[model samples]
Target: MDSMGKYIRGYVRIRLESPAPERFFSLCVHNRIPLRNLTQEGSCYEMELSARDFLRLGRFRRKTNARIHILRKNGLPFFLHRAQKRKAFFLGILLGLVLLAICSFRIWDIQIAGNRYYTTPVLLETLSEWEISCGMAKRNVDCQKLMQKIRQTFPGIVWVSARLEGTCLIIDIKENDEIPQETPVKEDTRSCWDLTAPWDGTVVSIITRAGMPLVKPGDLCKKGDILVSGAVAILDNDSQIQRYEYVRSDADIVIETRFPYYDEFSRTITVKSYPGEQKTYPFFTLFGTDISWYHTPKNTSEIYRTERQLTLTPSFYLPVTVGEIITIPYEKKSYCYTPEEALELSQKHLQNFLKNLVSENAVILSRYIQIKLTANRCRSQGYITIQIPGSDKSAVTPKEFPDLSAETTE
Candidate 1:
């Protein structure tokens, strides 16, 4: 027992030795081979040779041509020559431990911002519906799908994002305020509500404060009808006086409008292959890092490669974006339009525009084309009277009126 630690352990394979079985056993036992473990396969003797006695045994057996290998000092596997297998296992374990520690300490608390209408509980519930929860793997979450779900549930939400920081989820949201939904009302006595016009006609309803109905249903009222009830009451010992107040008035007024339609009008309708205008991506760089993506033009003009690239860092992004870059050689192709083609294109464009306007509640009784031409640029002017069905209940009214009776000196 030479402390087996002081000596290196190795093996030798003696092949084609005559009287194989007896000779091999005799040599192994006499040489005092580290035969603590041994295996035999046909004529092969797998023996462990200690470093200290290996050289001496080699000299004693001159007939045997042996192979000697110096095992590297670092941990090596039992059967592998010059193998870093042990080191590999150790490194893998280390990495796995490190990852586990990180996961254990990661942020699991989520914070939400820019949420006024929706309480934290409500938003958290919505996120939970999307399978986005605290302690979940960040990379495993489908952000786009969650965003879509939020949009579906809350159509008033303009934008939303969810990210994991450590073990905490940071949810950011922006609400669309263009179409004013009902906001939380405060108990302010001075706050007043907006009063809009009712119908399109002459103003026959007038009331300063809350008291009585100033105009009836068929009272020839127009837009901006204020019917009896915005005046505040104050009681004195001898008299009662009207004061500032909040009021709303609904009125029905008759309106007379005219529209003229003509078969001829100057028209060069642009057949837009896309809707609206394409946005451009913003570009910025700082300290050799991109603060923003390079601004590029969207190739909406071309029929191919209209892709979108989202910015992942330096969050300021342009509303516009350019399409993908492409190289294509082509000559200009133009076509001439006949009168019928021009007229048809113009009619379609006008019809679509009118449809959109009507969808927004604009009344177009009739339209007339005073002039007609065929060019890229055309001017259109018409007289239109819109009849709004709501009345202005606001107590505040504009006092400025045009001086229609003044004579012009020029």
Candidate 2:
């Protein structure tokens, strides 16, 4: 406690010179003046004491006839006193502290969580339109109103919450699971749907869950051909076919298909090389506005890139940022590649093109490639035969069953 008081109020080291130094020490002890690190040098005494106690020692020094001189002064009190002489420095520090305190009340960061189908940027944009973005005052944010607005904006969101955690505003959301609606069937009316082929391919496998299969494995089917029927024949007690009961058809079908791709590349490529001359522009960004602190370059053809560094608090809170824009001039040059280089580049391009077609359930069965080289260009054509799941109900159409009673009577 005493050390802390000394640090706050300040302390001074003093040298007391007197012919009767022992009497001076006795007077300090009798007067209850706190002294530390006391040392004697001939007839002089040196020690340190708090600034407040040093002021009160004047009366004791008069009685002991000791001349006291301060050797050093330390702590916050002295430092502040020195800073008081420089008005600009003092006001700048005061202004910075005031700005920091004010900025602490505003939202410096925004975070989103619990989102799957909805993207974070989409949610943030919605929140921004609702006046709940970074740099906005925290007191102005109405969590309940924001939640209601979010729910109204995205109907799929089942639950949402917006709250402030320190300088960051966190928005959490939950989305409703998507469930497919089943088609209804009535006893009086018979409604059936046909599962048609999506493309011209040979069927590799089929699994029917609620339908009668019309196409089997190894069967060649054309596009829009029915692969399954939802109509089922109903039997009576006399072993005769009665009315037809219709249902929604469900099935999983796999098909083998061939995909072809073609690409062409030139042997010569154009590349840009940087020159030596460069210019930099420094700027300070507050909120979303940039205040330039340096002159901007006038060269429009120069390539430029921006780098930003944020000024943050000790705890990693960002309220303002500093940025630099560096501009460099470059010259474009063309370089011709050898045949081997062109072949390698074309091979890499072909591999990348084929990689984009691969899926988690797709299996490659066969691949064929044909490369042709001209004087200045190379052309490559390739095709891959892959087996993939091809269950598509887009071509399905509902059909009404014909009345069997009328036909039997005829």
Candidate 3:
């Protein structure tokens, strides 16, 4: 048998003191008593055997006239004998298991995956709207229904998968990145809108697809000035105003403009330096209750870093979060950035600002920034000329645009 099998079946270590221990072994062989790890000292012999065989050794003691004593007893029976007195400890363990079992059937956490455009809070709000939330029974959550309901609620969500994983509801989503073609266009006269200039800039390019273009290339338009008119005037045979038709303004207009950029920061800052002193401690959180063995001093300044969670399953995380945290002690010191360093940092910030503009489909033409460094401050002020989308849709007022029916037409 293996070690666990021997331990589970119970074993005993025997010490035999006899003039001729060879006689006891010969007798054990004859009677079929297996001995493990047999070792001999000067006069006494030690060996291990099953607890049952130990009981049958009373006859062999008489036949060989050898002394037999149980030096140690090991196994499940012995452990149970010692643990019978600690009933409360065992009861607490059983209670904990029961609690975990009960909690497994109820969701305690929600995990969202494969979402980019839709935020976690937005998806969670949709789930909450459908009466799905943490602490609800897992059985009540139909995965198929959840997938269907989510797909129906968010038209942009092309695919969805919902599953219960170890007291957690995991939802994976795939959003439709392409423009929806099946979307119904709003033809409601009361909801007529116009594309107006969102910024004061000169138009660089204009393409009118579903509305009458009011501004062409090289034309200057101020903020709120209509760049595309939704109210297309219908002229009569004599070129007189008859009536007007309203539409949802749709067009693409790029405008060239200058954006003011200003950033100022102190050269002197407080920085933390680690002195290579860190202590790690294992921690466990059970249903919001945290237990840890390590504690930091009251006057200590340190950083606490938590590692990944420890769990029975590799990817599945339970309500009980187990992990290790390292406490790193550090010292805060005053540091000053040199002029060269400050200038480099300011340029980096400026680069990030221009990068964001590029991400929004804006083309940077030229940047004229003036950097000034004083006793303790670094400042950069300038304007960047760029071509960017300049049109914003707004509901057109009847008084503003001639989209409404003529009073005499009624």
Candidate 4:
């Protein structure tokens, strides 16, 4: 049949004291020692010899005490031959692993450019949340899903791109343009109240850009108060005609706001006990799509959640991620209340409230012993003034009100 189980070809290695390995090989052949595979090793003769012929050779060298042993035997030469042939395969596998490692390290150093609104760190963090992270296989990542996630995370990034260059991932983004402001003209006398205050507050100081101010500093007025008027009925030297020009005013006002603080909490704890029970299943489907060759689950009073991913091939399936599960069980846990425990809980809640309120950049202007905690609710309000610089340009169009003509037809 094949090269396996052919003949019992025994190999012998001997050191001839008098002659060289070639001379010894000739002598062995002449003596009809049935030498088959022969070779030289330094001053020794390595050859394949049968048991009977080996005994005869040993008899000739009995006085000299020659060294000899079987190096190869008749059975199967497949293991050694196949092992020799697999060198390239093993080398390829090693190179593949090394390349993968290098790619993994290089992929982490992602750089982003053309990003005006979004920072690199912010985009990378968002990508990480969607599982499109470094070290993850490029084939497994979805480009469309990543783009959608980016838009969802930062709507300001109008357009962006995610691509790999050699090993680094790059993101490009563009931002939207800002809107321009508009101001009204104060040359029209009828437009006095038209140039009204933006909000209700006491007038601090006014800077008239092109028109005279009606309200001075320290003047308290409502929201609709007019600071600058556009109406100008001034007479011209040549003709007693009135002229109008645009005007702007900058004023600061005070306003009021309110904020509230409340706490509503619920908590529960339990101790669980387990009863050891187990069973094995020949096969099971994971992720509702993968078939597990074999699996077993232990019975315990625990709420367990398990997830796995498998790669299916034509003949067999391999596990991508297996044996990652956690159990959170409910138990008969009891809470004993003591004076110290109650005080601790109350103090902790108070501390949490203080920390939360102080962390909100809120300034506690004043607080009174509001005993009138009207079963309705406890409320807090604030009043502050902000200055809004008015625009110095006109917003009205140059086109005057068009005249309508009527035609009488017979």
For model 3 the local lDDT of residue 368 reads 95
**Per-residue error (Å), model 3, residue 353:** 0.8
What range of 10 consecutive residues in model 2 has the weakest lDDT sum?
Answer: 392-401
Per-residue lDDT for 1-410 in model 2, tens only? 97887799899999999777778778878889878999878777789998888989888778877799999999899998998789998889889899888877888888788898899888888777777778888899888888898899899999998877767777888899879688665633235466778767789999999767898999988877878876666667966666566656788888787778788988778987876578787777777777875554554337455645364643335666676777776778898878888888888987786676574476788888888888788898988787777655532343455555677542
lDDT of candidate 3 vs native? 0.85
Q: What TM-score quantifies how close candidate 3 is to the native fold?
A: 0.57
Candidate 3 lDDT by residue in tens digits, 1-410: 59989999999998998776788899889889999999988789899999999999888788778898889999999999999999999999999899767877887778899999889999899889888987688899999989998888887899998888777788899998887588666676667789999888899999988767888899998989999988877777967666678888888899998899999999999998977667788888776678889777444556565745434564345567677877777778899999999999999999999999999999999999999999899999999999998589888655343443544653
Better candidate number, 2 or 3, judged by TM-score = 2
Reference-based TM-score of each model: 0.37, 0.73, 0.57, 0.36
Cα misplacement distance, residue 27 of candidate 3 (Å): 15
lDDT of 4 by residue, 1-410 (tens): 42222343333443344343445556666777666555656666666555456667755565345555655444324344556878988799889678555554334445577776677788778777777665565567655666677777786767767766544566666766565466755544333333466555556566655444667767766655555655333446845434444333333322222223333222332445543443332334432344544433333344343654332333122223354334433336544434444445544754565465457443343332211122322222232223333322223222232222333567
Better of 1 and 4 by lDDT: 1
After the best TM-score superposition of candidate 2, give how far the Cα of residue 404 lies from its true spot, in angstroms: 8.3
The lDDT of each candidate is: 0.50, 0.78, 0.85, 0.49
Candidate 1, residue 43: lDDT? 50
What ranking emerges by lDDT with the best candidate at the front? 3, 2, 1, 4
Backbone collision tally, model 1: 33
Q: After superposition, how far is residue 328 of candidate 3 from its true place, in Å?
A: 0.7
Candidate number with the higher TM-score (3 or 4):
3
